[model samples]
Target chain A: MTATLLEPTADPVAAVRRARRGPRRRYLAVLGGLIVLATAAFAVNVLLGDYTYTVPDFFRILFGEQLPVATYLLMESKLPRAVLGILVGLCFGIGGAVFQTTLRNPLASPDVVGVTWGASTAAVVAVITFGLRGTAVSLAAIGGAVAVALLIRSVGGNVGSHRIVLVGVAMTAALASFIEYLLSRASIWDVQVALQWLAGSLHASDWPTVRAVALSAAILLPLLAVLSRSLRVTQLGDDLATGLGARRFAPDGMLLIAVLLVAVAVAASGPIAFVAFMAGPTARALNGGRPTLLGAGLVGVVLVLSADFVGHYLIGDITVPVGVLTGACGAPFMLWLLARGTSSRSSS
Target chain B: MSVSTSARLVAADVTIGYGERVVVEALDLAVPDGAVTVIVGANACGKSTLLRGMARLLRPQSGAVLLDGVAVHTRSTRDVARTLGLLPQQPITPEGITVVDLVGRGRHPHQGLLGRWTSADERAVTDALVVTGTLDLADRAVDELSGGQRQRVWIAMALAQDTDLLLLDEPTTYLDVAHQVEMLDLLADLNRNRGTTIVMVLHELNLAARYADHLVAMKAGRVVAEGAPHTVVTEEIVRDVFGLDNRVITDPVSGTPLVLPAGRHHRPSLLAGKSPTPEYEGAEYL
Candidate 1:
């Protein structure tokens, strides 16, 4: 009988427990460590600014003790900025990983494929041409992302990841030209505002912006979590995934969720560059490449918060926004990754 | 951990293809339960397509593949997955995935919605590694492995599924001679010891003849000759199916058929090196 043929393993059933528990425990520990680091960075961003509000000041401000300059600076502006940064990072990190893992291409993230540029072009058009302001701009951005994503899908011809990247590259180029053309046509004051938004800043952080991102997260994160298990299996080649009972529709569904996440993220933070692209591979390395969405998200939070803090405080005189800093840091990293050419090498 | 079901699979009146190009048409075949069935054919001959259809990786345009008298496509895929496992040719191994983790993915069908990796999943993975002699490589990354080791690791993953029926497509394409034998031997052990019904597409005629309990030789999208390998593998069938002249000899060791293509040379004797035709010797020399 097959039962008799199953050799008695040298280690008792205990080996199985270790095999399952060991890497997961280590991954969770690393994720917890990253979270703690992000939280510490966030606290410093809130409390260690020029005015230097302490823990007591934060607590008192929370209790409605309006301590003039400290309350306005710390509780009102910095607090919302830091919270919004974390949510935006989570969206980028998880969304990027979802796209990369499902498509099985490291360069398939929304950033690489012009999804962010699509949103920016739409938002810029709304501001300059339509003369739109407030929530309409955000809606325009989301709509842009979805529309561009659909365009990429159509133009890329369902061939593979490389095709999507090529189409995305073309889209990014075309949109950049259009954005520049729009910028040249705008008034001086509008140009400054558009420039700042294009660079991706958290300068005008208020509860409403924070609340919008939070509400979106509240709805989307749980939906993503429910689908995450199926996402893991879909990472295997499609034939094997379907062979294991994953629905034939799983990849398309995951792609939709990824697009939605990207759209929400762009609407909130104006397409923070490379957070989505880098988060997946970074988290993959941190956990020894098993593909953990949570790990990617935590890394995203850390990257964004640290970049923001550095942008605000590290430089003197002129304040550089977080996206500029991330772009400055990320461009070199992307070049190095490109030079390494390992992304194309990770084949199925 | 317990799956007790009939490993009976049948493809009835099946017509399958990719878009407009038809691969196999009007084919009816039943897999012998608890036995090894090898489908052999020349290039682009639809052997792999048939295997894929039977494994439910492809749907027939006209007919259905039935498992235990119920249509496989109509049945719950989760249930079918638990009943059957497949190791695709050259499966993709994600970058930097550990051997143990890769094999544990086989437990996907057994997993719940949350996919809590159970102790049983672990045991199955470990048992599979041990069976395939890759237990020592459990911690190594798959990309770092040699091709043969990677193939064995993939087999371990399939074995971890612990299905009653397993289908493999060209499972030995990448292995060297010794390793190919070793891999076939391992499959044979699984068939003998566990009674797992295996359906595979193999290109090597000699190995197919030696190992298959049921050998199906295909030509132009139809089974040309099929039976026990000893009966089906012959000069006439080889010439008909493969468009080649061949002599079948008994493998001295296994007592199964061995195919040697009849070509420009044969065993030499005292007076044997001339062309057999009269037109080539007397008239042409004159």
Candidate 2:
């Protein structure tokens, strides 16, 4: 009786392959489309800024042939800014997706979990009280994010993922108050400098800042790729992940890498609001609700570039900071997610 | 009874716990290879904890869980996973993951970082789905499947791991009576056809008694009795393990020991005047 039940009726290998093809194709198509979209957004950000330049002239400037007005504007500002945007976006996207996946909560992005607030508070303190500039401020931001991450872990102390998020929220609130207190004590000129920390701005982008972000991505992304196989296993929760032979510390290791990615990106640019928070969900939505780390990273690039463009050009008069635009856009989406009640669909 | 020296998995004086709570204390048992072993006890008797300890989900604090004569915890997890598979109770289903993709993930220990999906991997996954009768639901998202279908799909995932030993924790918890029997039958088939060593925690006593080749009854983190179901599942053991007033009788259909709880309100009119342990001819009726 059991033999008859165990017998295979036909070739199921073909059925399994056929089942996989549709989703595989859809994933590829979504991934390819994101790459194309990111490229276009980068182009639009660089070539169509306030002082617009033609494609040939932009390339000529890139190739080191100086056209008087185009040279300083393109080389000094637009190129570095756009490049920095893409790099920061990649870091935030990949890092945030890892956080959300591992913690099994969409709201567990680094920004929402106090990493951004930590960076901003430290950056503001460096600029205002310490009179720090450029690389020193960036260092402060990186240190701040890492410090907050450590604080969260120590304070939460094996309380599990949901408790960690609650602890982080409390930390973010505390750090945010510290920032406000510091701002209240600052002079007008200091306030202008500190505004970048309060709301993320790409206005400070230079070759050095671009290099810092690039170098971080260069070292970190490959490491992340090496560690990502366990990421897939870890998403099934700890017990099952262990059952499936995932390394004992793999989730913690991935989270640490994610924290560093967000830190470096925040160090290069001020904590760009919601890029980390929004990218993963967007990528998942685009890929027929499947998680795609690469797709999320590309989506992050597109999001930052487009947000930067809109913040820089689309708004009238004063240039709104990239973080401010993202905040405004992200708040609505967050509310939508809340209204949708994600308990039924959330994946760990 | 002597646990044979050839037993592949053994827990010798193992203690398991979480934080300050000691759940299973200094327990010893050897799992018979290629047989279905069902563990049944009241809630919090530490039966599940013992199962977790054996599966290496919880590390033993005092002694070691041995697999193939070596400390299981000392072995590389991937190597252990290739030999033993586990289906955790309430395993998470990633949002929008298809049945095939979820099942394919059971192949994790088999593949390296750069390993591509080979025909062998495909065969394993297909065989799993086919054996579990989930091939028709291969393309459907896991969240969309019914409770029974989802349970089968999870079993398929474990089956896809292609391990010789499988451990399940309460695999039939949420299923109706029919699905529970269906699940047990499927596991029995795996044991018979694939010669897989099966160990599971079950809440239903009569079902466990009917299906298990070996039955273990635990009370307060200690194994009170273990042997062939008929020998181990007497009315005295049931009262001792579960603290329930019950009668043990032969199942009319399966010729296995069947437990009939003697609740206050359910006494039959015909049996009201009879001796409590009245003998029956060949079998007992419900």
lDDT of 1 by residue, A136-222 (tens): 988998999889988998888652357888898889899999999999999887777576547777777778888988888788777
- Which parts of model 1 have CA positions greater than 4 angstroms off? A1-9, A157-160, A339-348, B1-7, B265-271, B274-286
How far out, in Å, is residue A156 in model 2? 2.1
Q: What is the lDDT of residue B97 in candidate 2?
A: 90
| Model 2 Cα lDDT, one tens digit per residue, A1-348 | 233344454667788999999789999999999999999999999889678878888878889997887899889989999999999999999999888877878888899989888888889999999999888898898888889988998887652369889999999999988888998999999999888887777878999888878888888888778778886667676777878898887777878888899988888777889999999888988887778888999999998999999989989878988988988888998986676545556532
Superposition error at A194 for model 1 (Å): 3.4
TM-score of 1: 0.92
Q: What is candidate 2's fraction of native contacts?
A: 0.64
Docking band of candidate 1: acceptable
lDDT of candidate 1 at residue A347, scale 0 to 100: 43
Q: All candidates: CA RMSD in angstroms?
A: 4.1, 4.5
Evaluate residue A201 in candidate 1 and report its C-alpha lDDT on the 0 to 100 scale.
74
Tell me the deviation in Å of residue B68 in model 2. 1.3
Question: How do the residues B50-78 of candidate 2 rate in per-residue lDDT, one tens digit apiece?
Answer: 99998898999889999999998999998
